[model samples]
Target: MPAVLSPTYREVCLWQEQVPREPLPADPLPHEVDVLVVGAGYCGLSAGASAATAGATTLVLDKEPLGWGASSRNGGMVIPELKAGPEKLAKKYGQLGRDLYAEVDAAFDHTEALVKEIDCDYVRSGQLYLAHTPSHTPHLRDFAGELQRSGQDVQFLDAAQVRERIGSTAFDSAIFFPKVGGLHPAKFHDGLAKRALAAGAIVHDRTAVTGLRRQAGGFEVQTTRGPVRAAQVIIGTNAQMDAAVPELAKRILPINSYIIATEPLTADQLQLIGPQMMVDTKNLLFYWRLTPDGRMVFGGRNQLDPVDVPTAREFLYDNMVRIHPQLTGVAVEYAWTGYVAMTLDRLPHVGTVDGAWYATGCNGTGVSLNTWLGDRLGKVVTGQEPPPAFAELKHPAIPLKPLSSSYLPMVGRYFALQDRR
Candidate 1:
């Protein structure tokens, strides 16, 4: 961490207006409810709002405050494709693959509309997915051709074109997606929470769920506060998954990703970085973009396990400088970590596991997908609609089981090595 004083290394959200603060107050814990949604992040709260609107007595509970999870910590890039592109998904699931991609596309539109409804500094700015190595550029170039033939709003940019857009030679080439957008994640989370509350759902913060079991006629949720009975439950927790539901824990691996925000850049510096959200093709990839106030927020997951924020900040700063040497020694105003939920399939899953509904596995690009899936879950639980196609697919459990964390660092090291090659 740069020794330069910038409010004393507290883990500030940077997107929030206030500094570290208390969790918002909530209604009294309900002894019984029609729909119980765990986790108050984007997906959970969205489900709460929808369930409540559908006339289900809903309650959303969280272990931490409303805006204290990856939902707020994420870069707020609303890219609507799954980890696999439409073409790849089409190859995998045929017509259902195309339909799943359409669902994600609808998610992007829903997110845009919701952002507008909430007035959260939404920008319809396109995104640049850069090729991190020379070997990757040719693949992206060919992939861009595939996307174009399928009528995607995409373009292939050679190294020269990429430099014109990014002012960085760190990447070899890029694929542009004009439909991507950016927003204030914290605002969106808080706004969605408020919407949930206004819809007559109760949101309780700082309430940790210890266990959940289906009982006669409903499920009993054991929490740090007390057990609450619900006719239906949605295990909407993403990266914060714990042993509350062993089935979810078996499938979701929580990995830490760090982010650092530099002091507001100069006009000249912004010119160098360009005004678009960006990500790279590396296994341990990098994502960056300019905040509305011109601060550059750079994020990556070079290391998956826990590390002190200071160490992560320095590593990211070194990488940031390597990517844009112009930012060398720039004051890092904030550094924080958020967990990304990963599964063996590298895709988000929505299904009824262990007799409870769940939508986990964002794979690091879930701002839009989570909200959409959560909303779909709300409707599904309320008998308004069926589960999305993703639920019908098989959800694979990670190999190595409970001992996976012991060898996870080795996997991280291998990914870093692959990024180098």
Candidate 2:
């Protein structure tokens, strides 16, 4: 008999298999709310929870099932990382740059608190960042010292040490982040949803926001169910913001990230690759880790802009074998794809656009950054505090916005070529 095919994200995600996402029951669409949050991913739910706790009547609307986006589809690696390091950031924004880094550190702290509260299978398994080539080794070592000076418990690992940690000689040197860890994304999302509901925020799944117009009092948000008047609005849609607010969408480029899980590995295979979050330094990088159940979950970029799932699976599988040839013939048990928001400046942006406040452009670090910024935005919406330091940073505009899609594939191919060298 022909073998049955494995389930892809079109059916169910491996991480989400444990915490099933059933559609939310239909609910009354209130005519008015103190705050309306569009998108029910990590950012929206977090914002809604904070706003409701601040005594606002908050409503969170999503076009699909809860955690249906990148929030649940990510690799679950929690790194309090920004694209620009402290030095470059200071050079760019002065004292505000220091505050930006501090904010990310606080985000990490928030995740640590949530991991215990959520009871997700979170392991404080350390993280390792590898240098892809010898030429790139020294820069990473220096960066480790920079982070150490800034009070992070980061250490530079030599070639022998890296092999000892990961059991692979594919890398020359590496940096170890002891505080970095991994968790079940879907479980965390489930816990967050419960938190939002307990805090009195109403979450309406499958309710798409069609239009957002600033009115005299505040804003008239048109959803598929009906129009709701909102005293304040927060856009947390990230990659899907185009459908809700077109002008705001122009600020971000949606890039597709794909992942595949190999069947459970043997004890010997597991020993060859220690179970920690592993990422290599390349323009087009790869990250992989062993799931709690022993499957090797590997993820990376697609070769093109528009995702072809079959092609993504093949590409990732071949690359995984290239990195660790032990599992060349292992069957892939799962596959999935999610869109990551990339800003021109390679950093997240938080502030207003089209009169509605927003926090987006996670740049592949959404697991921690999104939740923290969303909480801050929620508080700001209810007058709890001022705009976050990120608000002071510029949201770089894309050149030739209408033609970005046409040029994305070209740029992706360029990055792929650079990865080869």
Candidate 3:
């Protein structure tokens, strides 16, 4: 397959993905606001909601309708913590590891609370990381042990126990993290946007900002519809963020992640997948879960390509049937794809430049980390003390070098190979 060819996003966002929405009208007036947030994805919505609620005249704009990006188009697996475990974190960040973990835990809690006020169809059932191979089982155990040693709550399940929970004998072991869970991402973003609007944020969907320039006291944004002036600007778009800032665009590369939903299966077929969100032990990293409608949603990493509905559906039909042959007869009802902002370190970047602040590059953990950083960034903008946890993060400008522009494919292929091992 070509490196850039990805399936369409509509196919697998969720069993019942939110439908396309009409655009919100442009801001009637050009006025200065306390904060100007770009990208209506989770990060923007959360930050905009918090900022507007905190008494700032916040303005949020998106290229597509609200929740049209990866925020509403993702796997919906709410895994907490950095992709690396404590051992790797310590190796990479030293003393900062503990603080980061604490903040990640807090992020999980924040997501739960945010979901409560909205109707996102959230389920706190937690997540199960299954190891299909015996070799992978030790990694899960060691990671769970490290988490426990760091005073986090995680459980290790043996082969038989894993089968009991997942209804699959394909895995040798599993690690369950109650802090992580699943939800309907589309609903969450939409609900949050509404809350932000109610709290005084001026949201303009289908409004893409064409240019940004520094002005006297703050900045000026030129949009397709009109201009927005704000003392401070925020870029909340994650993986779908392309060219908002040239430096950030280099640090974060967009990769296509595809998913497909199977038609509602019979009770017998539903038994094959229990009430658990699963990420298998493969470099391909298949994460799947059973939808409320008894349909199976399966996702995997695919090349970034020009995608459409038909192409996405075909890809899902091929991929989903491979995981379970019994699902061969199960027709695919949807196929879709989304962009994830992938960083070199797989950690989110949260900082400011000039007078513009940004929280991007959540990698694949935008659902939790974006909301976490949104709340954190809101505090920073409001002159309130930011949580000490984020103090450990060293906000350096992402390098805009040749390797960043040219070597992403090579680096991605290497990491993909490692994940396969």
Query: Please, what is the whole-model Cα lDDT of each candidate in the order they appear?
Result: 0.86, 0.86, 0.73
Which candidate do you rate higher for TM-score, 1 or 3?
Answer: 1
> Residue by residue across 1-421, what tens digits does model 1's lDDT show?
2323255446666876432445676556989999999998889999999999999999899998768899888898989877777789899989888888888888998898898778677898899999888999878988888788878979889889988887888888899999998888888887888899899998899998999988998899999989999999998899788988887888888888888888889999998887778999988889989988888888987766678888878788888888888887678888888899999989888888767899999999889999988988999999999889888778888897788779888888989898887
> Number of backbone collisions per candidate, in order?
0, 0, 15
Candidate 2 lDDT by residue in tens digits, 1-421: 1112345324346887768877787979899999999999889999999999999999999988787888888899988878877887988899999999989989989988878889778888889998988888888988898888778888899989987776777888999889888998888889899999999999999889999999998999999999999999999988777767877788898888888887789998898888789998887778899988888888887554766766777788887877777776777888888888988998889989777999999988889889888888999999998998999988877788789778877988898777766
Cα lDDT of model 3 by residue, 1-421, tens digit: 1112234333345622544555676547456788888888777877787888788888888888666788777777777867788777777777787667777788888898888898877887778888867888888889889989877788999999987776667778989888777888777777777888888888888888776788898888877877878887888877766655666666676767777776678897788666678787775577888776677888776433335656655665665565455676666657777777767677777766556777877767778888878767766776775644554566554455444646655655775667655
TM-score-superior candidate, 2 or 3? 2
lDDT at 418 for candidate 2? 78
Candidate 3 deviant stretches above 4 angstroms: 1-22, 27-29, 302-319, 387-392, 395-420
In model 1, the runs with Cα more than 4 Å from the true position are 1-9, 17-23
- Overlapping backbone residue pairs in candidate 2 total 0
TM-score of 1: 0.96
What is the TM-score of candidate 3? 0.88
Assess the local accuracy of residue 18 in candidate 3 as a C-alpha lDDT between 0 and 100.
48
Global local distance difference test of model 2: 0.86
